[model samples]
Target: MQDLTKEPRLSKKQYLVVASMLFGLFFGAGNLIFPLHLGQIAGHNWLPAALGFLVTAVVLPLLSVLAISAVHAEGVYDVGRPLGRWFALLFMVLIHFTIGPLFGTPRTATVSFTTGVAPLLPKSWETGGLLLFSALFFLAAFLLSYKERKITSAVGKVLNPVFLVLLFFLFFVAYSHALGNPNAQAATTAYRNGGMSFFNGFLQGYNTMDALAGLAFGVTVVTAVRGLGLKREGSVAKVTAKAGVMATGAIGVVYLFLIVLGSMSVSHFKPSAEGGTAFNQVVTYYFGTAGHALLATLLTVTCLTTAVGLVAAFAQDFHKHFPVLSYVQWLALMAFASFLTANFGLETIIAWSTPMLMFLYPFCMVLILLSVTAHWFGRDPVVYTLTVGFTTIPAVLDMVASFPAVVSQSSVGVALTHFRDSFLPFASLGMGWVVPAVVGLVLGLGFHFASQRRQAGAATSNDVQPDNAD
Candidate 1:
């Protein structure tokens, strides 16, 4: 058997490959459109708004990856293992569902179709087009993800670079042509104030869902690192962190570029309802008829890479925990489910996903923060439980409040919304959980230190008694 005690590491080229794979996994449908949309809304204030977006979009996701590495977690399950087995299992299931077939996976197909292909079809044929397109999309994803070991090479070496080259080409052409004056555009009503613009941008970043993906993608990165001959856990984690930085840094730069692109586009076109629409408009304006084909290819390639990563991560983790189904079986189930969900259309998928994102983002943020800081508190269960417990109430309330207007307008929803707004600080801003999470952290730490002091005092008494008896 090979000695696992020896420290091993990937060379610079291997690290770059791993980083590229990670970039492909995280930079999916939402990553493309969200920044573009934000740019239009923030307009002249795009800088602060973009910075805010970066906090949740770029910074939080990067922290999550490092958090996994910091704790030497094997996967999402291990990230939550400090809380307990059942909680860990539950956390893992929820995360996989959110980022897998339910929201993230289906979204890839719908987004690619709506942004890239739908414009080419007649209005009446849009529905049929989506159904056919998503079917093909998921099939392609399934094939790509069938072999787990080859994912790194397939995505990192091939699809990622192709997508980047296409995307950068679009950027270069737009800049060369002087699409618009971003500075001249006025901020929208929602983003009129700089502080609110920042907060709105921060909240907008939640839509990218990259932080959740970071947790799910941790295993993939770690596995790739291990395959590179890193046998020691610490070495694997160290290299994983490096790869994450490289990947997210690239993602951040892309987000800024897209945001700037969006801001510039406003000079020539009106604000679009969605970023996908904005992207389509911009591409059409610059490339004319050929842009349609280019965008279709670009989006399909981008979303396909992400879909493969999500499906693979979901299957690998689920099969590890629940072995009743083989990895291939789980993969098939996810693809089918995602295909069905995609038919619901891009708008519908996004509408339903909002509430779930609102609910889950808080929990995800808290968990990531705790995991990163676990060393300071020695990864105490008391801290984890109490902190999560405090976060749950607000998260649930936020979910209720964020539900579609049909539900939010109901009596029950009104009551809960009222209660949340009245009692929870920052509830109006959709960040009601922030203050409570902080309070929970402080209280949990207090209890932990108190318990430690009592234990130390009892040990001292026991020592004194032994001396007295002697």
Candidate 2:
């Protein structure tokens, strides 16, 4: 085995290549479809909506990578270790599970089915069609991720450009054809109108789930950086930050272009119930049957690349964290779970995952912010524990609040709803945890400083020692 402890380095050209790989990993799935739907719904308000989405989708994910890099940690699991071992393990497991088999992996197959294949298939074939498509999708992804040591090669080298070329082609046609006036559709309730548009878009961007995924992906990204030979901790962090910049810059442009496409198509297309449907409608209108083929091609490539990256990262983490299962076994488990979930259909998968997302995202945001600002509060474990602990009850409340009405109206749900609504500030706005987290952070800081002073005073007294040593 290679000495993992030894340092490695990369050249400028190789650096960019790996950076491009990061974008490829981040750019698939929601990166392709969500903004299009946002644009359609936002109508004339798409600009502000896009801004909002960018903050959560683009900004948060980038911050997540940087924060992980900043700490010189291996992954999100490491990020949580300072808080407590159990908490760290719990947080890590929840994040990986959420982004792995539960949502991210399965969505790749389901999304590819809807955006690429479903539009072309006969309506009668829908259920069975999804079954077959996802099976093939997961199989290809599993095999590639299972066998590949250089994970970036397949996704970065071959698949990314294939997807992007189609994307650029669509961007061209979307802007040039004037398929419909950009201002045709009125901004919907989901858009929340002009002033509120940004916040609404911000909320909508959470659907990308990239920020949470970033925590998981940091492990893969750092390993890729090291694999290229930049092995010193500082070098690793600096290089990883640069790569993160490139990834974000590239994807940011694509997301902006996609939002514009979404807006312009509004005049030409009716609002579809789902983002993928809107994507299908827009592509079909511009290119006809050939367009559907191109879309399916694009969706399949993007989804495949994403699934490969996710499974690769998940398998590595699970095996490292829980050693009973070897890496291959973990990969098989992920593939099997993802395959099973994908067959249930896209909406079903999303509906089931929402509660989980609600439970996880708040703490993730807390962790990232704390990781970055740790020095300011003396890097105290108390700080992490306070912020994250305070975040849990509200996060759980949000999770319960988001459940389907059948459950939300139950006794447990009724109690959660009352606690969330009656006491939690901005609970309905999806920020109920913010104040409590800050309060915990402040209290933690106070405790930290007080402890420091006491230590300092004890040292002073020990130095004097009332001449006992003499």
Candidate 3:
């Protein structure tokens, strides 16, 4: 290995480039769509809603990156290891699947298709269009990710800047020519009450999935930092924190702008089915039919960079664990699986993803918070086990309640939903796990102190016995 002592810290230029790469990895499909959708829903209440969205989408994700750096974890497996080997393995698999072929990776393609290409085609052509688009998308991603070490250069130096330019240009035009009066737009029923609106926006942030992405992308980022000649763990962690802050700070600003743009669009156009369509409509309004090409280019470039990062991260982690497959083989498999899932269409993918997110986000949030504070608690396994255990029941209930109406309306679902709402605090707001998790943390801390005291007493007794014998 090269001498890391030569450069313990990244220079300012290197930091910016790395930060841009991190931003590229996080700013994909959900990042674009969710804020816009939240804006429309929140309307006159957008400020509180946007603030709430930033809590989960930006702040939590930033903390997650720092948590990985804090614990010096190579990936999610290490993050979950304190719970047990088996639990760590299971957590890793669930996270990769959620952020990989099952949901997130495919989402980039589907979102791109929905926002960029779908409008250009007839309604009947959507299925075939998505298939073709996603296939090509994953293929390009695979090719780029093949040279894993080049991911930062590809995304940061090339793709991310282009996406930003296009995105900012759209923002400039939208603001220059006011679309409508956001204050005049009535808030949606879900957002009519300010408190509920904030909570709803908080819950909606779960849809971005960046908090999960932060954990999943940890390995990729750590490796990049190491490549930059940072051998010391503390140096790596510090650099990671700085880069994460820079990257997420940019994402936060974009979210605010998108939410405002979405609210403004309400004057000129009714809210579309989703943020993708709303975004598309805004571009069309500004640039006319030709805007279709601009929107397509913007989304494709943005999504492709994320696809490359996700595929690279998944391949690296799986190969490290399984060893049965080469990194390239894992990359190929991930790209193909994501391509198949993308053909399910954006709406179907999103519908199915909501429940999975509800189940996963609670566990993820608990794990991340515990890891960040582990230093204070001595990194006790008991704390992790208790916190995660307490969070699990409500998380499962939330998942069941969030299933598509067809499944959630069943008798069993109805009973479970009733029980959850009756027993769990904030269940109606989609944050049923918060109270239980805090309770677990308190109980775990009490046990930790009790155990510590017992150990101290035993040591004192032993020391006195030796003195008496002497």
**CA RMSD for every model?**
1.4, 2.4, 1.5
> Which residue runs does candidate 1 get wrong by more than 4 Å?
1-4, 466-470
Q: Judged by lDDT relative to the true structure, which candidate is superior, 1 or 2?
A: 1
lDDT of 1: 0.91
**Segments of candidate 2 deviating more than 4 angstroms:** 1-9, 180-185, 464-466
Tens digits of per-residue lDDT, candidate 2, 1-470, equal 86877665567777777877777778777888888888888988888988988988888888888888878987888889888788889888888888899888899999988778887889999999998888888888888877545777887778877778888888887777766666655778867577578877887777888888888888888878777767788888888788888888788888888787788777767776778988888888888899889889989998888888889889888888899999889998999899998888888888878788777888888899888787787669988888788988999898898888787889999988898989989887777888898888888888999999999999999888776544
lDDT comparing candidate 2 with the true structure = 0.83
Q: Tens-digit lDDT track for model 3 on 1-470?
A: 96646765468989998899999999998888889988887888998899999999999999899889889988888899999999998998999998899999999999998899888999999888888888899999999989877888889889999999999999998899988877777788888978988898999899888898899898889888888878788888888889999999999999999998888888877777788888888889899998999999998998898888888889989999999999999999999999999988788888989999999999999999988989988999998889899999999999999999898999999999999999999898898999999999999999998999999999999877755544
Q: Model 3 — which ten-residue stretch has the worst lDDT?
A: 2-11
lDDT of 1 at 372: 95
TM-scores for every predicted model? 0.97, 0.95, 0.97
The lDDT of each candidate is 0.91, 0.83, 0.90
> Model 2, residue 151: displacement in angstroms?
0.6
Residue 202 lDDT (model 1): 96
lDDT, candidate 1, 1-470, per-residue tens? 97657765567998899999999999999999999999998999999999999999999999999999999987889889989999999999998998887789999999999889988999999999999999999998989889887888889999999999999999899889877788889889999989999999999999999999999988777777777778778888888899899999999999999999999999888888999989999999998989999999999999999998899989889999999999999999999999999988878888888899999999999999999999999999999988999999999999998889998889999999999999999999999999999999999999999999999999999877755544
User: Ten residues in a row with the worst lDDT in model 1?
Assistant: 461-470
The clash tally of candidate 1 reads 0
User: Which candidate, 2 or 3, has the higher TM-score?
Assistant: 3
